[model samples]
Target: MPTLPHRLLHRLRLPALLLTAALSLPTAAAPATPAQRLADIATRAYDDQARFDPLSATGVGDHRFDDQLPLSHAPAERARRFAAWRGYLKELAGVPVAALSPADRLTRELLVRSLQDRLALAPFPEHLLPLEHMSAVPVQLAVWASGQGEQPLRTVAQHEAFLKRLAGLPAWCAQAQANLREGMRRGVVQSEPVVRALLPLLADLAQPDLARNPLAAAARALDTPPAGLPVADAARLAAAYRTEVAERSVPALQALHALLQGEYLAAAARRPGVGWGSLPQGAAWYRQLVRDQTTTALTPAQVHQLGLREVARIQAEITRVAPQLGFTGDPLRDGGLLAWTRTDPRFRPFKTEAEVLDAYRAIDARVTPQLPRLFGKRPTRPLDIRAEPEFTRATASDHYGLSEDDGRPAGVFWAVIPDPTAYSVVGMGALFLHEGQPGHHFHTALQLEMPLPEFRRRTWINAYGEGWALYAETLGHELGLYTDPVVYVGQLRAEISRAGRLVVDTGLHAQGWSRERAMAYWRDVTGAGAAQAANQIDRYLAWPGQALGYKVGALKIQELRRRAEQQLGAKFNLAAFHDQVLGEGSLPLAVLERRIDAWIATQRR
Candidate 1:
């Protein structure tokens, strides 16, 4: 599973701010038409999304709704929200796109499509099985409260707001129980591994020791320590966690665990796959997800076929380079390349997490000088590397952080180091290239610095955002970074992992593959251990079709670059092409292609 960039939270919350900007745009000379009025209403609807999910808003740099948290598990509330969304969409359809400017028209289309997708996903009971290996409400809440991940926790007021937010945890936990009960009734519970994994998480959080607890860590960091507070207030909050763990969070987790152990686990089908084709309406839901993720009309079959071709092509490249790296025969079958890369002494574990971060910083120092050659615009903010917190490290992915409005918190590239030895140096270079110097850090930082509309700067299309990072992986060779054959192999291995995801994700959900089957396939192909493979599979189970984005997106981008190079011939400017891609902010692949094509035509002229 791909780790989301911290800045993405800010992007998700930008639609509302964009709505405000849309409203403030100077009115046309004439009185607004019905179409214009409808567009305004649609804009308002998009803005309303912020109110429904305030935590999401805060992530996007919008502090307007900082104090509110969404009630995601309440069915009645959700139904009412969806109904309002649908009504807005219906009303928006009456507006003529031709009446609005291009940007506003795109926003209208995206909003309508987003609403329709939400409506489509509503009936699936996804809310019931929301907590998974990839994300849990508890983890997200902790990050939100810590003032570490996009949320501001600097001032006394902010601290109080977080405590207020914490006070609602019991209610949220109860809602989660309600959702799980609903899932059990509908036979739509999470996988057994996920449920089992969650048990320990609950146990850890519910432990009597507040000082060591990740949940209480934030409160300790607050200006007014909970310990020094009025006894009743402190006792009340502490009791809430106690009751939350023992009564709500713990029992609910245990019951869910029992359901998985007793029924779902046994009945759990073999093979990990992607999509919802097995269940009723599963196929249609998956189709929608592919569309939403890729922003294209390509079918799952098309994506699967494309994955096959990509795997073959990438494997051939690997085979060609194997002998040069000291492999004697059939690299894929012998597993020489995989073994050498994974167990190489140079990739040994760091004694301390600081050493691990120092490695990333070293890569940045080496790569920054070369960035100006590849990219005309670079981020002004500094890049720092940090270790993921121990509690969530097991499930966290290597992520990049976004800068705040004040530019105080530099963008950070966080690598989750569960075990030091697992941080392979062979993989680190390419990973750094993708997440640090020329990948997310550069791309996202550039977006923030751009003068694009507020929404475009902050919002992202997965196809473009992930595609750009994937694109950066290939840029290493051009940027002169993947000098060692081992590093190159790491790049290929990364590609293979993404390609394999298409196969395994589809296999799990669509083709009824079990967890063991999926893990085995990943281990066999990527040489990832059982634990790592299990984590990846569970992530796919948690969020279907998300893993498919990397390769699918990367392929589209590679295709565009190839076409651009062929068309422009000697006139092609690599730097210019990169600028064209990054400068427009993130767009759906289709829109990106159109923008690129227009740029190409201008260059040809």
Candidate 2:
């Protein structure tokens, strides 16, 4: 629970020192220049980013900032942050890129450009609709209260800290109302279906049964009774749900529901696209987001086109294996492939969640020996598998979790197992490869172990991180993990899933496609059933451009690897190439390519 500045500076110190040292070393050639100074400033800029978003720090295993949260809602606070960003940009403009090392230069350019882009978005009324279907005040409260995710519920002090957090629910709901009101005035409202989803979620929170309520469950777990405190303390910690839900949260929901019903829903744009194009300056904002997220200057049209090409390539691969899985007739016609996979008995009945986890664990065991063949370095932290929590599992995907403060908990691959019958063994092996072993678990854990700056460790560029995982899916053959054709199909299906995302995500937001249209696209393209298709579309709607990052990133990484292999020919070392890709920490794809090209040149020597 450190202050924002403290948390931000703490994570930056190590990297700053290392970077300074690197720059000061007598080059035996010449003195440093303005560009080098700018690179140094950009590193500081990244430090500022780490501070502004502490949750991001936790994900990167920098626990120094775990207690702080951004208050982006306050106008004064927003102004202060904006001023700071403007100062950083001004400093960046003074230095040139040519004087810095390639790595530092890229960091400087990206940091400045991203900051400018973000400032451009500052005028938009995003704060009004900050809490949406993807994330909201209530959902975050549930996550923090559950004591299972990022918020540690371990010690007495930690427990009390949570109680204090819970006490602020009523005020948070009020803030949400104010924000939503602002959004309404500005015409930046959510779609009807998203607003409709909130009613049931809020009603569940407002339930009278304390046992079933997540807040009450946490309060009851405390060693001391929270009910017998001072009037003010007791009132604060006690169930504000009754008053908040009835007065604020529920009414806000109703207001939002009405807005959607009366205004936004009827006028809701039908294109099932994922971008800011629907709002004022949306096209420019989306272009900037594409640049920021991918860490490359690729346009939306370029990304959209890349998605098409990758989808075709992967579909051809899928066709190669579909027949071997005992499928007859065309795989893409008449729902044949979907029917076959969904009804296949080999894919059903796990009997228990443990069985599902064990299946992933077993894949972890099998994939260990192949690691040294493809990766010279491996993660010290172990990997585990578990079931995702039930409440959010409906919209959640299988995800990877980083280690705890002490690193004892180990990284985990959590499979969302709402019903065992829905589990498809056809894809489990590939899923394990991507989310569990040799994929996210290995990539993320090892990155945490690097000696990079704290800011670099905690920072994320979705394209490189997720793209590497998708590229890892392609490594199953190289790593000897896809011996089974069914599992091979699983890997293909996983790729298909990413490729399918490009079609549906853009279709929904950019193309004016309806929810049904998007869902049908996923079903037709990937052969995922109605339920799976619906969940995926809902996920995209909640998270807009996020889904596009996976396939987009994966394709870039795959492309880079192919380019390196083609150039290196017989001298190309797979293990060395992977080591180089990861050694630089999570970098923008452009930076990553430069690093790899350097490696390729050294090999040519």
Candidate 3:
């Protein structure tokens, strides 16, 4: 449930433009071997990608572009980025893959597939339709500007660089307005609900009170000098910040607020329907979205059917545990025990936000001691739990935020409980397992600390990333953390929720299902509250094909684990298998299969 950075999208689509300087490196006299060629390409690609994506660069501890936010919404910029992708594809196509080692070959295959995914999206007008409820630019920049995100604000120079970058907000917002208008002209705007969700967030940003405004508060914090810094210098920087925010940031955000509330929302409201099928060439675009997100060719009908089967399977398991939790009834009648478990007051355990966080901390404590039994390795970065920022907590759910490679900040597990008393404890264990331990923190922290290719550490493929977390959800049983019957049911409920994703995601995007229908189906299958169901459906609308990754990736991992255990028999080590998966970092599900297969072969020998 970690929010994907907006710059990651930039990295995928605009990795080429940043490479203009990188591609100018001198050619070797003789053709290099495949290993050397791949190594060189990865190094160059990471450098160039960071150049195009300064925000991402800052996330990974690169400070070179700390003072810049490029005008990415301009048409000219998109054209340049598209051209760069083609040029890099051509360069990659020339590499002789037949001569490379297996590991190098895997990296080549992944790099090429990633480039193709980026190119596949270029023929469409998605660049114009950039803002979404899940990762809107206005919300993300506020987070960064508040010094709560990847942007560094430790040193005086860092703060000055941020101020310079902050000064560019007017131009950036102007470009966004222009692009949104273009998208409206092209009939490619986001859904109405997604656009409407932006209204309140932007309103909060445009608030006049500096104390209430997240961005202004970040600037105001500069009033206090850090460590040995002079008070006069800090005071001077603070004044400059307020001046820039008044003259630049506030007006830009106000303009953005007007555009969203007036033009964009009206246009999107007039659209025929929320699904991609309503737009021009939307059917083909949705198909491509499925392919890119899942990295598979399975049709919508196929994924939907698979979801039906998985949902039923997980429900049966939940029913089996129902009796143990003191819910006795006809085993399979009208959602049976699952529905009872959801509505029963016994399941609603938390009375306050502190209580919810304490439960999460307890879950983490219970899992930590058992972690070594399940894996050969663990992340060096310590994990901390915190409540989500109140401003965005309504839209945000429980998620894990990663730390920088330098380890200046430890990774955090964020729980957003809007109404603490109403918080359901049914899936708390599975959620913590997925978002906290051996899930995101486990996957991301190890990648940062590992001595792998920079690309591998930073790659943000959703299917592989989210899928691994979902897979980790199932590990609660193996790790001895799902001891209580209620906790085990929570795990089952979590799995069913993921299974619903495969169905509802494909149903909404590819099958022409309405938003209302998707919500209905989600409620029936998962027993989620109205707000929870509505929020998830809007997220799927905002990000087509993304929800499919969780189930697809988890199923693939589970399938591979079964295959490994069956093949190696007694020799199969769960810890080694897990290490093989996590140690390589995030991969496309296809690449993951190949890696696991290779490991299974080695174990057989």
Candidate 4:
């Protein structure tokens, strides 16, 4: 670790000493006013977060800890995070909420919820079951190393900073292996199939060939050191980085792969038996996950039933589009139309990848003008559609990568078009709405643009972010783009998919449904293909109750809009309501509801 810089050592030492003394005293005894105390508390919380997960810190534009990657699953570090959460809650308890402005109270509420959630989820074996096919530490480190992500690889210092992180990978992997073994002992393990799926991916990550090994991609980034760096230093840094990856990182990942494929794979649950409830205390754990994920008090059963009702409701809506699509059958009752749309020739309009890419751009252009009607605040940042990077496009799913605040690599929505002819036109509009404009791009960019507190800005509420995206899909109707029958049904299918997650996620975990049973229910409700259903089911298995948030959050936002519209009547401005919902950046659903209710009352005047 680098020593404290000589010039600021004394200055930093004084504040560190002062902070130590002040933290020991009663928080109420602090000299700052309540508002100042809250601000300090928020700042402290964010700093603690940055320190604990430095990669995330770098991802969010805080470079102070860019050089480090915490072995968070390690015992001492885990305990420290737990202690920090408890400590934050205790400090927050001292804040006099009544004395603060409504805004600060909301801040307090969000912070409290966020901290409490950490504590609530701390007891779960999520840390034990860390590695997944989608993402974990390995994928993250690879993404950062590729130089396409948030961490800068341009300057000599930046390159060295990442080198430090690369050096830490082996230790983190060792700890991760221990945790996985512990999970196997405690009956907290991933499915055999998921593990099997992940084995090859990890192998690819640890491959001997630099072209195939994702982690080694970091070395290529080091090939271009900042221009001013001395040639000797640059070459040295590049060699050190490649050596670190080849010597330390790849071997560590290989060890993990060997462990998982050998013993962990043997110990893993079979497909039908993979539900969380099969584990000890898993029922209650699933409930806690529900509470944590949805940010509401709804039980797993309630979510399941809500999913059922929504499936029926959306199925009814799907029937109305039958005439336009020429779909024949009682799809409204049993979803024949959904299956029909998939096979319908008209839906497969794209013959080339270029056509599919241009269609998305065209949709963005068409929807650009109508945005003013429903949103008072739109993102000032430019968002464009692009194919995923050539390296990962074949495997990566459709996703939106937020632009750096500096704007060197512009924000882009990456469309994963493995086969253009296979891309369905029916879902394109709603997909664009969710992943591109007025969804993630809008939600994320607006937060960066706003002058919110750093902690709040970076502290993404998954429910809010995803729910807002789901909610954003519906805005297509008001934006005048869903006039196409195919697009309208596409929107409904997307909603059904989210709704199906509610049932299937809760069913698999809480209702004791088998993987096959979950997939069956999912298809019956959403009319999704078998592959799609299996993929979605596996995802929920990887992260319980996480999928629950999409629909739950969107429902809450829609409910708040209804509440606001009912209260304000003809005076209600959708743009204003949307602004209120998004103006504070991402929020827990309950905190978001409070903000909306307050907005409703204020508008009553």
Candidate 5:
């Protein structure tokens, strides 16, 4: 039986005490620092982009919109996206970099540069030339549905979602065709060779066989039930998937192929040049592409000169290695070291595909023992090597495809084995290093594992990533894998090829070099096989300025390492220097320099 006064006192006592404690504490919580605010902006920007670019979202392992596919190549839609980029750039510009922490400043610079590059090329007619080997929408969809790409097909929901995406193919291809039609009107179409190359690719997609049709293959491949799902449920889902794919996706692909072969191919034949310079506003467009890819102001001419210097330097190295291999043949003669070594039976050690794969595996195993000595951190995911799929084998470049950290799909290092019976094993070690351990696999997987912001984790600056891989190729020498003279020559030739890309890529697009001239120069300099020369030249035409990133990035990294070694002297730890370079995943070459400079300053202190 408590009185009113007693009850009131009990309730008020707690409230009164709490009020006194609050009053004694600080008046208001401190506002977020400028760096924190900028970080928030980055997070928001990534989320916004993920929503807009569903394909990118899937690639980053964000399954929020696994079923959605954007008609990004549609001219009006593309304009809208560009407008949003401008708005984002404006907001980013308002941020005060001077007030940010060093790390935050780097982040701000990266985002700013990324936006600026996108904005710089926004007005260009890239959409007109969208369907290239590097990023063909039709091929990409089939690849996605086939369960070989980033698209997930493990769950019943995922499989259904993929069907929806597959269904979107007709609309996407129609938009692409419309864009190409506009390009034809404007004389901004792709080269004849590039257009002709698409025929075989289209034929592969038009296969009637359900087991062979890439889209249908995705559904048929679902032979087992996903976890927790009954066998009947899985079977039902697969059957439904096959129906949509056969009836919908297959027809769409056939229609698109018809459009390409009948209309697009004829149009391309009427106008043919490997260079974008052949189009309206071509020179300016080429310059902008250079800026976008390299993130530097160096002109195509300057890049050409740099390439010449590197070619001579690497050629000299190759010549030095030639005499040691008992091949007295002139290294720079018409055939050179490349011709002799490639023809020599001793260099072609692998008689079978299994043996070739084993060599790469051995390279991985050999390099694994030495990784700790050069790198402080190693990616948890092991690199899985596989033969490139038949559909893409002709046009496919050897590359590294990253996997999710969840550990289901191991990162793949695709080795494009064209002639299995007589594949040359000259530079397999360096190639392995570039595409596998300590190169792409290390740079990409480590980035995924890092405690980085979402954008930083996923952002791929071409120069930084490619340069790191090229630099990784050099590490094979230090790791004792390049002990053989022939292997050393192989490494030198690979370096020369990268250097030659600088010369040849610019020659084709910027210097007004004809396709014939470019191919001739490639043969004269690197003595590359005719097939190799043609494949690479087509790649450059399809993807302008991309080839420049490798040499530019590698040279910058080599310079930084040289500077670090000089400044730190006895204090410079190779492992620590490598850790800093790869610690932040990929960076623009400029940001990388700033980061390395900061590390250098810290070491000096």
Candidate 6:
């Protein structure tokens, strides 16, 4: 929906190692109060964490590490990072929970739970499995070099730092290859499908054509002097890029291409080796993924069953919606109203990019006024819509991409209009609700503005984050965007897709459902076409338990809201309820539940 869990900075993987670091504390001679102790510890830990992960630090608005990307998978760096990891937990454990205010306690719990989860995953050597088809080193390189990502390219130093960053990549690949070799020896490798899926992307990056290479383009662009820069500095900068990125970096990418195609792919497992259950120590690993992703104790089996119930509930709503539009065919069928609406001329209204952008803006206009009644805080920037180049529009779905927080942009509501005539208007409003204003844009923007510690402000617990966005879709009714039968049905369909994920994700990983079976089930429940269903199933294969977070998180938030309304009766302020949920940035669902429970108790008192 709103581009995967990068809001949580999934790429910034924290390695769990065994070592120690001193937690910085208040320098005042007097003993710090519990609240002061927590603030100090969290602040110090957040600063250290930023320095530890340069890429993550860049994403989170810290520019100190803009030039350097550490060798995270290398043996020694992992050890030092873990030492800092332990210090975060150790410092927090020193704070007495009884003495701290609820707010500080909440931050403490978020940081501790985060560190503990990282600690728990220590047994799993994910570093060895670092190469992802979706957002691996190759993908990140393209993005940063294009000046669209967190890595700053404006300053002469930033440009130089980037060249240094590029120089580091070949070594990173070597380290990754070494780790993959170790994984191969240990019976831990990417599933064959994942390896194959990654090949094309890597091969493209390894292409020798400098014109087509974004990495090289970034370097060449430095040849032009900036407004105040000396001509001499520009020449040096351009030469650095030529030597480091062009001459050296380009060759390294080619080597990585050969290594993966020749060796790593050969080592990956065959068909149906998609899930973690197929890997070494797989069952436990899958379980840990479930725990870390959803922040719950629910097993895959339990999650699957919960998904079954949820799928049925959402499906029934979609079915009820069809009759209002004079469509009676079974929506559960692959060739029913769900597919018909997509191709139906009446629903495929937009004929140009301008039309599509206008529709999104209109949806925003209608929803914006209503949001003030629901919550107090909102993003400063109004949701902005931008259409991709005609050829770049690969899907009909629209999504929100969070800005790198460099003041250049905020959350963007991207309308992917591939052939506008082929794009359906049926679910457009629901898409807006999920990806626009009150959905991702509001939640993420508000989070950035939170006065909480850096870690808490930036935290993105999947269940809490994705759940809130999905739950926000239901606000369509309240916001008056879903009163139209088509829009309401669209909302149901969007939600049902997530519900289907709950079933299909667990089914594939835990129940041993084949790719064919998983795709079929996904289509049956969500009415996705064969190709769409297959693509989605493979995404689940790439990320097990991740799809579960959407529905699981939404259900939990819905439950908490119901509990609050029932308990508070007329005292329940929708704004207050919303404030409670969004006030502390995203939280683990369980921790969110506790906050809501405490809020209810306080209101009663």
Q: Which candidate achieves the best TM-score against the true structure?
A: 3
lDDT: which is higher, 1 or 5? Answer: 5
Query: Each prediction's TM-score against the native?
Result: 0.86, 0.83, 0.92, 0.90, 0.91, 0.90
Task: Extract clashing residue pairs from model 3.
Answer: none
Deviation (Å) of 106 in candidate 1 = 3.4
Q: Is candidate 2 or candidate 3 better by lDDT?
A: 3
lDDT of 2 by residue, 414-494 (tens): 788988766777788778877877888777778768775444555555677678778888888976767788778778778
For every model in order, what is the number of clashing pairs? 18, 14, 0, 1, 0, 0
lDDT of 3 at 576: 92
Q: What TM-score would candidate 5 get against the native?
A: 0.91
Off by over 4 Å in 1: 1-43, 145-147, 222-275, 278-280, 403-409, 452-454
lDDT scores in order: 0.66, 0.62, 0.75, 0.75, 0.74, 0.72
Q: Regarding lDDT, does 3 or 4 come out ahead?
A: 3
Q: Model 6, 1-605: lDDT tens per residue?
A: 01232422355333421122333444566245888777777777776666555665555455666666657777676766666668778767788999988777777877788787777777777877877665576566666676645565766777777777787788877777788788888877877766777777677667777666666657566567656657788788777766666676678778877888887777775423677787788888889888877889999999988888987787677677788898977866773667767667998887787898898888888878788899977778556776642322332235566544244746777676767787778888888887777887877788777676877776667788778889999998888877798888778778888888878878878777777888877777766677677657766777677777888888899999999999999899988898889887878888789889999999987
Scored by Cα lDDT, where does model 5 land?
0.74
Candidate 4 lDDT by residue in tens digits, 1-605: 00111111111101010011112323555647888888888887777666776655565566888778667776656666677779879988998989899878878887887777777766765667767765566766776666766677766777788888778889878988999989888877887756866776688778777756777665664566446667777788878877887888888899999999888998885323777788777888889888877878999989999999987788777877778776667775444777667667778888988999999999999888888888888988788776654444433557776535233634567787877887788888998998888988888778877787777776566678779989999998898878888888889888999988888888888888888888887777777678767767777776677788889999999999999999999989999998999998887787788789988999999
Give the per-residue lDDT digits (tens) of candidate 1, residues 1-605.
Answer: 01235423222211111121212222355236855575566545645666665555565566676655556557766666666677777777777778787767766665666667567666565566555544565666665544456666555455456556555556666666677666666656666666666656655665556566567655455435344346555445445444443454444445544554565544333313233565446777677777767778888877877777877787788888888688775677634476567876765766767788888788778888887788777779788777766777877777776535233756777788987756677788878877776778777778777774444555656777777887899988986667788778889988888888888877776677777888887887777867788778877766677777778777888888898999999999888888988877777788778878988888888
| Per-residue lDDT of model 5, residues 229-262, tens digit only | 5688678878987787678767777887887888
Following a full C-alpha superposition, what root-mean-square deviation does model 3 have from the true structure? Answer: 3.0
Error of 4 at 107 (Å): 1.8
Which candidate, 1 or 2, has the higher lDDT?
1
Off by over 4 Å in 3: 1-34, 224-229, 328-345, 404-407
User: Considering summed lDDT, which 10 consecutive residues are worst modelled in model 1?
Assistant: 13-22
Q: Give per-residue CA lDDT, model 3, range 1-605, as digits (tens).
A: 11243223323432222222333342565246767767877666666666655666666556778787766657776676666657667777878888887777777777777667877878777767767656565676676666656676666787788888777778878888888898899888888988887788888877777767877756676677666557887888888878877777888889988988998899999988888778888888888887877878888778889999999898778767778987878644654566666667777777888998998898888889999988898988898887776777767757777543233767777787888877778788888988888988888888777786777777777778788899999898897767888788888878887888888888877788888999988877777768888988887787777778789989999999999999999998999999999877778787789889988988899
Which candidate do you rate higher for lDDT, 1 or 3? 3
- Cα miss at 524, model 3 (Å)? 1.5
